[model samples]
Target: MSKLAVQLYTVREEAGKDFIGTLEKIAALGYEGVEFAGFFDIPANVLKNQLDRLGLTPVGSHTSIEQLVDHLDEVITYNKTIGNSNIVCPWSEVKDEESLELLVAQLKKVVQRLQDEDMILLYHNHDHEFKKIGENYLLDLLFEKCEGLYAEVDTYWVHHAGVDVIEYLMKYKDRVKLIHLKDGIGNELKAIGEGTAPVKQVMELMQKWPIEWVIVENDEPSPTGLKDIERSMICIKNQF
Candidate 1:
């Protein structure tokens, strides 16, 4: 079964102010794991100790493509020390076929390198990725070209792009390791189970997939970050 996690990007502001304290709050709110957006420059070992104390699993970290390609060794060492094995490239802009090809080439190398270190690379998407280049969507093309590149599907964006979320996810079922169980109407973000995204249906479908984590995220938290995720967690707990 997939475990419950929250993307730290949802709580980026609070984390910026008090990283460890923010983690404590997340744990208190009943999140079993965390997907980190940044480390606030904390030492790896130190972060590991805090996570251990809080009983939180380091599900994954969103590392940039540039960091993965140029500073992979350091990125790998840091995450490994904190007991994380998934490194996600959260966002990338590919303006045309040429740029897409370049991204594919760079990511292929990053995938192999991560595999060498017993880690995996996953691509996170936004609505732009659903745009078609020729006959195929950019996202499909990227996955097709970059062998061993896994997916971290964000449900809201898939819906926002005017695609059938279930149909789209089924296409990459084998490669999807993480699900960003988000909710929103158009561009305005909402707490999970409180928006137009197919949250319930997706949660049902998730049980059948070999997904590792179901991470909750609200790109623009309403009111405050902690309160937004607290409501999200309540919905998640009710479902599970």
Candidate 2:
């Protein structure tokens, strides 16, 4: 069976208000794990304790390139305390070839540092990453150059990019550790199963890959964010 996690960014407002309380609600809602977007002033031990009490596993976190570059040690320490092994770069703006190359070089070092600490770095993508540079897609180029980096494929973004998400999932099976199971139609984001991102077909294709977590995220949630994710959880529970 595949594990289900919520990218807490989906409930950023509630989380910003009460991180531990929000996690308790998430656990109560039947999600097995959580993918953190921010810490929100909660102590590592306290966060871990809340998660433990509620039977919620810390799957990973969506960190930025700034954090990875500037405060890597601090970031690693916090995640290690919370029992999160994967450090994901959610998105970055690399407008030019030089910037892309710089980012890739930085990633190689980041992954190596993570490896030393018995952790791994994952790269998450958005539609902009699909733009071709030379002959290869930018996403592929980054992975190709970064020796031990892993992929946290976001399906909605892949669809938005007009790429075959299934092909990427299969081709990079070995490197994929998580799948961002967001839904969308065109440029608008939606809660899982609420848009036209081929949720069922993607789940079917996922069987060919060894994914660790299928995380639900809504960049643009509907109504109340909590309610939005609850609906997404129901959709995932029924279908996946």
Candidate 3:
């Protein structure tokens, strides 16, 4: 079966309002798995039980780097209990070259600690990650410095940055385990298939890259997220 998952970030507003109820609706929509962003302050047992009832296996999450540093033990414990093995740094406040360099240095330590806990660190990238970092792009620099670090390559962001996603995937096939399967969301931050990303070729490369998961993430709202996401998921499944 296709590893079709909704990143859970798309419906962030709805989830923030009615977390478990929203999940029940998502589960009913034929999504095989989900990736968490927040827990809505629900207790771990209650959340875990709800996920169990929905047969929702959490593939990963968008956790803050600061939180991970200050509460590594608590963070790891919580993710483990929630049935998620991969805790990803969605974005950091690091923007400039100096900050990016410092962030990578810190990430090395974080990855080491997470390894000790028997989990992995997956860095999620945005359009800026492909921007020049002196000689190399920030994404490439991160890969170079952070050994054993797997990445969640956001296909849209790479496209937005004008980098060749297929080529990068080929360059780091072994290192890339997960992929965010949304299309282009340039300055406007459009929906899944509504932007300029090379949607078809990316999905084809994903299969060839032998990527593990194709997660749907839409940063902007459309008329209805479910319809856009469902169409994207359906298209990919049919391609498979």
Candidate 4:
């Protein structure tokens, strides 16, 4: 069975104000792990201590490509200390062929380096990745060109991009390491069960795919953010 986690980006403000307290609350909400967007400059040991105390796992970190390239060593060391083996480039500004090629080269090197250290590098996407640069989608080109790179598929964006979410996941199922179960209608982000995305079909696919984690994310949560994810967790628990 796939484990449940929350992308901390959903509660960035609360986390920034009270890091340890926020984590305690997350654990109280019954999350098995967390996908970190930032560490708030906390010491690795201190952060890891809190996680250990609460029995929360560090699912992965959403480290940017720029950080992965310039501060690769620091990023790797911090994640290692926190017991996280996955480093994902959550977003990048590569709108054209020249920029895309540069990102591919940069990521290829990062992926190989991380692999040598027994870690994996992954890429997350939004609607723009589904846009075609030539004959292929930009995301397809990235996976094709960058060897050993894994995917952290965001199902909401894949649906927003007018693609069949399950089919898209199937196409790259072998390379998928994590999945974001954000639901929404068109571009409006919503809690898991409150949107139009094919949640049932995707949950069914998880049974066949080697997906390690299914994370809940809502860029804009309604009636309070934490409460929204709490509701989402119920939806995920019922579905899975």
lDDT of 4 by residue, 155-210 (tens): 98999899999889889978999999898887788999989998778888887776
* TM-scores, one per candidate: 0.97, 0.97, 0.92, 0.97
lDDT of 3 by residue, 1-240 (tens): 237678888888888889888888777777877888877898878888998999988889888888777887888888888888898989876566788778888888889998888889989998877777678888888888788678888888887788888887778878777788776545775555667777778776665555567788787757556666776666665654
How much lDDT does each candidate structure score? 0.93, 0.88, 0.79, 0.90
**Superior candidate under TM-score, 1 versus 4:** 1
RMSD of every prediction? 1.0, 1.1, 1.9, 1.1
> Model 1, residue 205: displacement in angstroms?
0.8
lDDT of each residue in 147-213, candidate 1, tens digit only: 9999999989999999999998898888988999999987889999789889888888888877868
What is the lDDT, from 0 to 100, of the residue 175 in candidate 3? 77
Error of 3 at 213 (Å): 1.3
Q: Is candidate 1 or candidate 3 better by lDDT?
A: 1
Tell me how candidate 4 scores on lDDT: 0.90
- Each prediction's total of clashing residue pairs, residues at least 3 apart in sequence or on different chains, is 0, 0, 0, 0
TM-score of 4: 0.97
Top-lDDT structure, candidate number: 1
The prediction achieving the highest TM-score against the true structure is 1
Worst 10 residues of 4 by lDDT: 204-213
TM-score of candidate 2 versus the correct structure, residues matched by position: 0.97
